[model samples]
Target: MPIFLEAKLLVWLSPLHRESWLWACPELEEKPYAIVPSPIDPSQFYDMKLPREGVICVTSLFEFKGRKNVLQWARDHPGQEITCAGGNPLPNEPLPPNCRDVGQISPWQVNETYNKHKAFLHLPATPQPFDRTVSEAYLAGCDIIGNKLIGALSYDWFKSREEVAEHCGNSSKLFWEKIEEVLND
Candidate 1:
């Protein structure tokens, strides 16, 4: 009588942000995880780089604007660290590590990356239907920082970009306070 994208429930089953980001990077299918844009590959728009400033992968244009603000704040404060990667899910951005294919990365590998990274930076550069990045980072256990409010199925798990900036401007306590509020519930 009827059909579906795959016939299965196609569940959104995730702790928070994992599933959405996995799909964004086709190259990551084997490993399947989110990553910053790949500079070497122009077509597969993964992470965004600001010259000597640094790099960040945008979940979408909406996220781009939010990250820009963080960039400005980080510039003023200076000294923040970020790591990048990519794979097949992206037709736009290329993978940074030539051998350790992102699409094929195991959960443990993904966890390793997560442990080293401080937070997930998602700034919606534009206003669109919804950006799934917030959920991706949350699911992966990355401290999410962004402007776009993804009040979707998990309506309670996001914060405005402005909030993130405030936390950045203030002490680390504020940062965890916000994170606890959003994810703990």
Candidate 2:
């Protein structure tokens, strides 16, 4: 913890993450910090514009990822089919009948998965510094349905597809620019 405190600047993935950190380490309020989100290549995901419907969750089935919430959502929406694409379920954790686990798929398959669904659901039990899947799902033309824990949703870009893509395209440059500024100081 002391080693981490020695840093000149702390770059956070989102405002929510920054706030969370500040809450935990109030003393760090005196330190320099920046909010720079992770980038998502727009090319890797595209809106197929198919007749999309239902919901899909692209998250690992772990407790921290909100495996319990996922199950609850499936149970709540008995009529709605919730397709999940991720593996590593905690032992003895079975998904509800409406929730179908497609297991873990390659990154290439994620775009296709989003295309098939109208909405993307992400409800992590704990706060995620940033969940790139939310941005990727949005880029693929899926409506994002997530809780406040998803750090990406706290940013303005998450509201519009164009803004999301633009941010993704510029994120790398922005990150480096921040780094340069920190080094120059």
Candidate 3:
């Protein structure tokens, strides 16, 4: 299920993300971390200048075919730390030393993490059309960022990318000031 980001919260993304920090797993303390999308792209955006030490990587993690690819992906990259929650874990696999399983975090945790860090990262390049992570991250006060693969939307694009980002950035102060702007017109 996809979460619909309210128009009031979309404006925050407008400001260039300068925090240089990302909501990451506790295990990140011990490793060089990076955020990567679920549908891995070896070519697109390859060779990123890894962020400075302690700078969190804002990237996507995903639930793949009853097996969480994000977990294995993180394992493959020993030094990279990752954040994964909100769904069932990959069954029968041994927990990787670097993977920090936060379990299903409550919405409050998302909000708290957003406030304390740069943003809650999880822009998995999922082909399943719309990804609810956007709405969840925004509602939690994160600046909803997009992964490159952006396949589909739950509603018309006009409704999602537009209003959701608008609400996230709070394009109109009135929208943030007034509750009316939270819903689709």
Candidate 4:
């Protein structure tokens, strides 16, 4: 806190963090700060034109990521194919027969994974600073199924997949500009 208090600038990863962090230390308001989300490279995730099918969740299956909720939802929809990817697996929470736990995949495989699925389910139990997976999934042309707790959804520009994709396409430029401003200041 003291280090931050003495800093010339602070860069928050998302708008949600900017709000929540400021509330934690209102004194920080006196300093310059910028909300620069971690940029997602849209070039990696292709926009699928072909009709996509099934549901895929790319988040780690940690307890805090609402794994139990996802499991229950999968159980309720027994016929639906839910592909659960990523690691940090919880103990004893067996996946429903309908849900397939593919565990983690390489970065090169992420785009392919998103392309294979029609919908992306992101239901974190707590507020994430910013989940780039949401942005990646959005760019890959997957319909996002997430709660309001998704920090990226707070942005006005995140209205639709196309809108989010546009923002992400320019995210690198935006991020660097913010950094340059901070450096110059």
- Expressed as tens digits, the lDDT of each residue in 1-185 for candidate 1 is 12322222222222234334344533333431221110111112122221222223333322234445544544453455433333334445432331122334453354345434446555444432334444333333455655543322233323543332232233245434544554565
Could you give candidate 4's per-residue lDDT for residues 1-185 as a string of tens digits? 99999876787767887777778889888888777666776678777576678999976477777786677778878988999888746646677888888888999888888988998888888777788898888888888888877778778888776677677677678878877887897
Scored by lDDT, the top model is: 2
Clashes of each: 41, 0, 17, 0
Q: How close is candidate 3 to the true structure, as a TM-score?
A: 0.39
TM-score (all chains, Cα) for each model: 0.35, 0.95, 0.39, 0.87
* Model 3 Cα lDDT, one tens digit per residue, 52-168: 221112223334321344444555667754444554344355656765555666654544444443344443533333344545444334443344333222323324433554433
Candidate 4 segments whose C-alpha is farther than 4 A from its true place:
none
> In model 4, what are the clashing residue pairs, if there are any?
none
What TM-score does structure 1 among the candidates reach? 0.35
Give lDDT tens digits, candidate 2, residues 37-139.
Answer: 8888898888987888799997647778888787787788899888888875663666788878887888778898899999998899988998999898999
TM-score, model 2 to reference: 0.95
Per-candidate Cα lDDT values, in order, are 0.36, 0.85, 0.36, 0.80
Query: What RMSD does model 4 have?
Result: 2.1
Please give the lDDT score for candidate 4.
0.80
Which segments of model 3 are wrong by more than 4 Å?
1-62, 65-68, 115-126, 135-147, 151-164, 167-185
Residue 15, model 2: lDDT of 84
